[model samples]
Target: MTEVRSTPTQRVAPEEPPPSDPVAAAWTDYLAAARQLDGVRRGAATAAGEQARSVQAAREELTVVRARLAAQQSRLRERGVPAMALVPSPPEVTVAARSMAAGPAAVLTALRTARECADAADGVLDARGWVAVVGVWRASRPEGWPDRLRNLLVYGPLAVLGPVLQVVLVLTGSGARIALAVLLGLVLPAVAFAVGWVGVGRFFRPGPDGRLDRTPRFGVLVCGVPAALCTAGILVAVLTG
Candidate 1:
């Protein structure tokens, strides 16, 4: 007993508690599954929304492309192109189908490309139309007619109309009618000037560059001068005769 050594006391780590009740464990599993299902639903909804937007955009693009193509086809037909020549070839149809095979996004891209091509074609056609119109204008007018002279051709007629009517009234009618003609002389020239300004901008304004047809000063003079002269001449004739 005296030779026996004292042994040191060893500490034991405590064991973890046993698994929770089966019902509680099952409830926890159910909650995890429900959360995962909810997440999946949200993801699917997001994808669907994106798909719907893409589809709508593609449909709009298709409509625009179809309208442009139809217009171009009509224009080609008007320009003496055979209907058969305007139809897409089998290879072209196949190529177009292949381009849109990737899905709605691809279809949208193809439609946008087609729209740009249609716009370029429109520009070329418009340029050609302008050239034809300019050629006709040159042929109709005297060569070397300045912008002012060309514009005057349009403005001059409108300007003279009021004065001519006033002169006619003066020659045919007396006192009250003459007074009416005189009053109209003041009003009509301003009206004529406004009409000519609009007409010049609408019909005769040059090209895609958007230059003004002629100076407003020139138009004002062309429109106003005739009326003023006719009014003066009418007064002189009335006083003398």
Candidate 2:
């Protein structure tokens, strides 16, 4: 009862500690700022590297595309296309530039697409060239001429050389010359066949690296038949005359 009427105890909240040193707080803030700045610098470096790589790749692709286009232009010119026709128009160039306005990445993509198109064009040109050559070959030869017949044409002239020489020697009325012609007939046909074989391989080849059916056995037959017949005929004439 002594304190029954005493005043209620006053409640006091605990005081917070004094503020930290100003220099330490400032140093902490400075560290955070430095870390942020370092992060920014790293991000900038990464972006710059990627951009540089894209630019370099675009340049390489452009070089390749230019070389391909130049070669194609030369080929087209040889095929009678005008140089002006091969050049890109101003509108096309403007459109291409607009397409790559976004960045070097876009430029690289455009160049790669152009390279693929150029490769396809090269394929088409090669096909057309092959067709043109084949057309010429077919037009020059007889209709429906097979490989054998075509090759025989090459060997025909060479095969007849021995017989022609024999005929000339017989006309000269020299027995020794006729005998020499007979000896030549044996050796000359082989030589002619060799020459014709090389000629056919060179002339009838389809492309720069293409091979054709040389038909060696057939060529031998074509070359030998004329010489054999001519030699037999000459022998008969010599014995009878």
Q: What RMSD, rounded to one decimal, does every model reach? A: 12.1, 9.9
Model 1: C-alpha RMSD to truth? 12.1
| Residues 33-71, model 2: lDDT tens digits | 999999999999999999999999999999999999999
Write the residue-wise lDDT of candidate 1 on 16-124 in tens digits: 9997899998999999999999999999999889788889999999898899999999998999989999888999999999999988788888989999999999999
Model 1 is weakest, by summed lDDT over 10 consecutive residues, at 205-214
Candidate whose lDDT is highest: 1
The 10 consecutive residues of candidate 2 with the worst lDDT sum are 205-214
Best-performing candidate as measured by TM-score? 2
lDDT of 1 at 71: 94
After superposing candidate 1 on the true structure, give the runs of residues whose Cα lies further than 4 Å from its correct spot.
1-4, 7-13, 144-241
